[model samples]
Target: MNQVWLRVAQLEDADAIAQLVNRAFQVERFFIEGDRINPGAVRELLRKGKFLLAEQSGALAGCVYLEPHGDRCYLGLLSVDPGRQRSGLGTLLMGAAEEDCRAAGARGIDLQIVSLRTELPGYYRRLGYEENGTAPFPASAQPKQPCYFIRMSKELG
Candidate 1:
């Protein structure tokens, strides 16, 4: 594997980020019926938050979204190429997100995962996040099965 490089996403990266995000989120097809995001949505997100992209060999390997809200930062859309799922790219992106939040004077980070993805809580847990609460999944999503959001948080040192 080539050395993975990290950078802040730019508006011009919308299409690539959208494509990479959809490809990485294909696993959600079991529950969700469409792409996790489109370029337009990514563009909108860019206006509110920043995405940290991980590239390997000139291709996007992973990305994570970070949005600072005063003392807490919201983290989301953590995606890693399916082929690179266990390669530590996700962890690397997460660390980058945390560092960025910490640098911004955030006291903690918050994120949410689909409850149906039972494996996700543990993944975030390993990174020092704890289940803080839950939220109703959007009705518009029309998931194949019942699901909700599991909110998690990690306080920065």
Candidate 2:
């Protein structure tokens, strides 16, 4: 396995982050329309929380967003570079995000996956997260097929 350096993203990384996220989220194109996020959105999110990034050979390999909310943290956008998917980068990023949440005094982490992504729940479950509930898919997403969000959460030990 190659060494991957982890760090909190900076403002200048917005473009790269957006590109990486868009590429990683292309799998959702079957149901969702367009890119997952833009550089402006990435900058806005930077103000609310932090993006934990994984770099391999100084290139973005993966990223996960962590927004601490009271005693719980909202985790999202766990993106692993498509070319690097299944290389354990997603798991690596998730572990780092969970640790960051714990250090920030969060009791648990919450995340949601599109209902159309039938493979997600099992992947998250392997990381100790359980299905909590569901949320309506944003109308703005303009999904091609009917879908909702499957909310999942994990309590930090």
Candidate 3:
């Protein structure tokens, strides 16, 4: 699909991104830290210059979060609009995020997906991510329900 590809994110994108995230995960929002997610935190996340949005015909098709993790970077909130799935947009965004990280000297890419989302881990594996086992949750990083998220990582080229 022909669309605008950019990493521009303003405070205004927060609500839209939140809505998209809410719809994408729904009952699985805990894994997303949705309970802890708000416009303010979204703004901070975006301010790090990692969050990105995909726009098609002036509307957002997907959103992603790429928070820096010391030498590595963390990929989270990889949500695509329900209507926009199966269009290769997610893969496109993932590539862009990975490329950006590589350019920034990240040794690897880290991710945390809910263990319950068995299909998602497999999906990441297909994209070259490998399971590194359950990662610890900082007492302040997120909520309690998604306590034992599976950690995955991919070494950058």
Measured on C-alpha atoms, candidate 2 has an lDDT of 0.94
Question: Model 3 segments beyond 4 Å from truth?
Answer: 27-36, 136-147
lDDT of each: 0.94, 0.94, 0.80
The list of candidate 1 runs beyond 4 A from truth reads: none
Compose the digit string of candidate 2's lDDT tens values, residues 14-89. Answer: 9999999999999999998789999999999999999999999879999999888888999999999998899899
Q: Can you write out model 1's per-residue Cα lDDT over 1-157, one digit (the tens) per residue?
A: 5699999999999999999899988989999999999999999999999999999999889999998788899999999988888989999999999999999999999999999898899999999999989999998999999999999999998
RMSD of each candidate relative to the true structure: 0.8, 0.7, 3.1
- Better candidate number, 1 or 2, judged by TM-score: 2
Choose the strongest candidate by TM-score. 2
User: Per-residue lDDT for 66 in model 3?
Assistant: 89
Per-residue lDDT tens digits for candidate 3, residues 1-157, read 8766666567888988877776766656545454436677787888775677888888888888888879999899988888888798888888888898999899999988766676798788888999888866566755545566798999997
Q: For every model shown, what is its TM-score relative to the native structure?
A: 0.97, 0.98, 0.83
Flag clash pairs in model 1. Answer: none
- State model 1's lDDT: 0.94
